[model samples]
Target: MSRRCELTGKAVLTGNLVSHSNRKTRRRFLPNLVNVTLTSDALQRSVKLRVSANALKSVDHRGGLDAFLIKASVDDLSPKAAELKRAVQKATASTAAAA
Candidate 1:
């Protein structure tokens, strides 16, 4: 409903536009949001969401938006899955000594 990304929690940011001449003006930085159908486990139907472009990129990078939503909707399993996945990733890192 709002002009915000539901998936990534991105919202419009208000600030001052500063010029080279030290002049400032009011401006707004809007989030890049798109209305999309996200698979919903709770409703057992595809739900619409306002998701940011970056979040969409994350989805795109890791297969697709559907895959990202499925991963997000899975409860109880996600945390453990994320932890294990991170651990495996960390172990595989070439710069382990640097870390």
Candidate 2:
């Protein structure tokens, strides 16, 4: 349970918080991570993921979990999300081969 978005790989960023007196303090900028259940059309199942709000919007823009995973880079996805992407790819490939 780290503060990271499973889909987009968004993580806590370290930065300086400058005060009114021109003093700087260390601070963290965290992504807006939300627990969401997204449906995969290829797998025909719903998967739970902790994703950033921006990532969620991208998922919608890209067309759903399957499409998003298919288009996403493997380096950006978490282990679980990468696994799901593989599964979805396999499932879709199998269907395409059959047809």
Candidate 3:
């Protein structure tokens, strides 16, 4: 797998490392990705994802995985996260329709 965050689409960023002598070297600024199991209240299941630290914090701030996915924009999310967002939307819609 690539060094990418599944939720936020965060990946390795290329930049220059400058020294005191004015010399520059190529360097990578990688996202802080971690494997986590998040439970979705809408789906009533646990899902595993490789997400960046910021994304995890956002999920918490949004209340849960389903809430985060529902509020997140598709352009800023990875393919997997987009799919999960769709699933969450569908589940919530079904629940609402049934109620």
Best by TM-score: 2
Candidate 3 per-residue lDDT over residues 1-99, each given as its tens digit: 999888778899999999999999999999999999999999899999999999999899989999889988899788888998999999999999999
Residue 65 in model 3: lDDT? 93
Clashing pairs in 3: none
Residue 38 error, candidate 3, Å: 0.3
- Against the true structure, candidate 2 has what lDDT? 0.95
TM-score of each: 0.54, 0.97, 0.93
- How many pairs in model 3 have backbone atoms within 3 A of each other, for residues 3 or more apart or on separate chains, i.e. clashes? 0
- After superposition of all CA atoms, the RMSD between model 3 and the true structure is 1.0
Q: What is the C-alpha RMSD of each candidate to the true structure, in Å?
A: 11.0, 0.6, 1.0
Candidates by lDDT, descending order: 2, 3, 1
List per-prediction Cα lDDT, in the order shown. Answer: 0.59, 0.95, 0.91
Candidate with best lDDT: 2
Q: Give a tens-digit lDDT track for model 2, residues 1-99.
A: 899999999999999999999999999998999999999889888999999999999999998899999999999999999999999999999999999
Please give the distance, in angstroms, between residue 74's alpha carbon in candidate 2 and its true position after superposition.
Answer: 0.8
Give the backbone clash total of model 1: 0
TM-score of 3: 0.93
lDDT of 3: 0.91
